[model samples]
Target: MLIGVNYHYIRPWYDEPYPGIHGITPEVFEHQLKLLGRVGHFVGAAEIGEALAGVRPLPDRAFVVTLDDGLREQYEHAWPILRRLGVPAIFFVNTAAIAERRVLGVHKIHLVRAWQPPEKLLERLGQSGRSGNGGQMGALSDVSLIESIRRRAAAHYNYDDPETACLKYLLNFVLEPAVRDRLITECFEEMNPGAESEISQRLYMSGEELRILSDMGCLGSHGDDHLPLGLLTPVEVQREIERSVERIEAWTGRRPEALSYPYGSAEACAPPVSGIATDLGIRFAFTVERAGNPDLRAPLHLARCDCNDLPGGKAACWEADRLFEEIPRREWYLDEHVA
Candidate 1:
């Protein structure tokens, strides 16, 4: 079985501390990569197909690394480390955000920060019927309200068709760094920005950076505005899939055959999306679900382990490696007993 690692958020030492203690610092990331290189076969996405097809030898301790939300940090921080270690990974990006040059769902957080008296923002959220206090508000946080603002801003831009107006409303008003920082602490526990802003001059991977990463053996795709698939209408979901694939293909000049779902889990991997993957001829699809890799039965529903759980960096990498090691034994037991 092939083990996969999902990573996001790498912070610099000097930046304002993240709101919560969830993101991996650059130092920890370096240690993790080194550990993986030392103990396992860090393979590229391409190698997985070869191994699954029985045309190539799978490494004794094979693993793949993947990132979601093609953040500039991947290029600035993660890319250099991956290059030094000679590890191949995949970066799943939401095309709409990239095209708009703004962050998606997280904008609501920025909007809340920008608008004083957090109560007003909460009021807007309540009006939208998407926010409630925990159970009452239905998991809507100050962050969710910010995300709603971003969606509204995007819709306005689409209708107005003016870059300047989009910049004024979406990028300028909601994405200021001070606003982002405040929201991180006040709203959500996690400090990392979920999306980039077109307005702010913050760092993100440039087109050239993307090209270099692709050339260096990193695959790319759509995490689709980071929405849970179960919540969207069928047409909306299709649009998300098509738009993401189209953007990546246009940028990379290679149609991506692999996709990773946002907030993906076994329960979220319904037949509709799986059928979409099959129709698109995608070779692989991934989820955030924690399980052993499927044995060619459903390549589209590959499971992965989130690296965020590993606070020990290199030690954590080893822990992930250990989990992969358990797969075969568990499979053997299941086959022998259950079958």
Candidate 2:
């Protein structure tokens, strides 16, 4: 069985007044790494891919640490702790941030939220004319759809407050992309004028840093534009994955074989997405589905647990007694769409 732990935003201090961006500090990260070391063997990024491809057998209780978003704080803070502990982990990056030298819209939302509370952010959304009582995106009027989004949001962002969760759901999944992008951009610029380039540079790892990680086989693709691939058309999804893989190879001189889907949600990792990854020669892909993978039978849809749900985290939910429970050998996700 494999336990994939996912992380984002590792920094020394999360000192924003509202502090929308949240993650474990270096001290907590190191502690968690050391604790995980006690129960499982830490493997490099590619090893898990190989294991899933049946090129090698995975050890019992194998754990893979993955940090998404390519945040520089990951390299500066998490990387050192990982290196000191000889822990091998993957740093999944969004190539657009590096290639275009601009902050991706998803990140813009994070920064804006960090700067303003949900009320203020929601007010901005309301002012957009596309946010009033199910204005254009009909999902707001569909009770079932709203419930579904809420369920997904609650599961994915279990740490967020209700208001914060609702705000994120609306911005990420409800509002139109162009409108959402424009609104977030306006808010981000208002928060930090003329700093998209500067912030993109500061927030993400540099090309040289990426190359170093690539040399260590620790770099993977998160996507090119950071849009939810499952929400896009198959052709668009293919473009996103292909562009990301190509840009990463161009930047690092080594093609990435592993990927952590942007958003990592069921919707984000849905059909044609994994199939596209397979066609692109991606050996394995991860989703934010919260469970330990019992086998590599469904390699591309491998499940991952959030760091908060594991030991030494702020909100640990893993069942201690079931650590070595018998894993059924059934394949649960092998639809025709999976390739």
Candidate 3:
């Protein structure tokens, strides 16, 4: 069986004015890696492919660490610790951030929220909705729509408060991409004038750093623009995947064989997204679906749990062995032929 743990925003501290970005400190990350080491053997992308191809047998309770969004902190903080501990990790990157030095809309929301309050953001979204006509953001004023958003927020972000979660869901998933981008960019620019280039440099790893990671065989594609694929048209999805693969290859001198879907949710990784990835020569993919892969029946739809759902996380079990006991297996694997 394969258990995957996903992480983002690993830093020394989260001293934002408010609770906008949530992640573990380097000390906590190291402790978790050590704890995970006790319960399962750490594997890498190559080993996973080998095991799936029947070239090598996987150890019992094998797990892999994946760092998404290719944040500089992963290289600066997490990579050194991983190197010291002999743990292998895959850093999945969004090419636009690394190549064009642009901040993604989702990250813009994070920075805006950290700078201001959720209520303030909701107000701005409402203003944008008014200007954009009655779109999804207009539902902010509808009691029923607000309630539905609250429920989804609770489901996706159980760690956040009701207000914060609702704000996040609306910004990240509900609003139209064009509207969200325009509104968020306006807000972000208001706070950091002419600083997008500066922020991008600090927020993400450079091509040289990514090349170093590629040399270590730890880099993967997280798509371009970081938009959820399922929400986009088929053509747009292909562009997102292909553009990322091409740019990453050009920058690093290696074509990425793995992908971690942007958002990694069912709505984001649905249908042709996986088939398109396969056609594009991606060997495997990951989703934020919380479960373990008992077999490689659906390599592209492999499930992953958040770091918080495993040992040494906020919602982790006290005993590492007991972790899998609570997580159900991917029952769909029974319906497909084992790879």
Q: Which candidate tops TM-score? A: 3
Give the alpha-carbon lDDT of every model: 0.58, 0.83, 0.87
Residue 270 in candidate 2, Cα distance off native in Å: 0.9
Q: Tell me model 1's lDDT, rounded to 2 decimals.
A: 0.58
Task: Put down candidate 2 lDDT per residue, 1-339, tens digits, no spaces.
Answer: 888889998888888878578888999999888888888888876677677556888888888999999899999999988999999999999999999999999888888888888898866665655545335554355788768878877866778987788788888877778778877887788779887898899989999999999999999999998999989999999999999999999988999989998888777888888888989979888888777777777678887777888888888875444544632222325545543
Which regions of candidate 2 deviate over 4 angstroms? 53-55, 130-134, 137-152, 319-322, 326-339
Task: Give the TM-scores of the predictions, in the order they appear.
Answer: 0.68, 0.92, 0.95
Give candidate 1's TM-score: 0.68
Query: On residues 85-193, what C-alpha lDDT tens digit does candidate 3 reach at each position?
Result: 9999999999998788898888888888998988898887777777765376665778887788789888988889998988888777887788778788888999999
lDDT of 3 at 255: 94
lDDT of 1 by residue, 138-241 (tens): 33346877567556556533323333233334323343333323433344333334433543224345656666666655766754555555445667667777
Deviation of model 2 at 267, angstroms: 0.9
Per-candidate RMSD, Å: 10.9, 2.6, 2.2
Q: How does model 3 score by TM-score?
A: 0.95
Candidate that beats the other on lDDT, 1 or 2, i.e. the better one? 2
Residue 339 C-alpha lDDT in model 2: 34
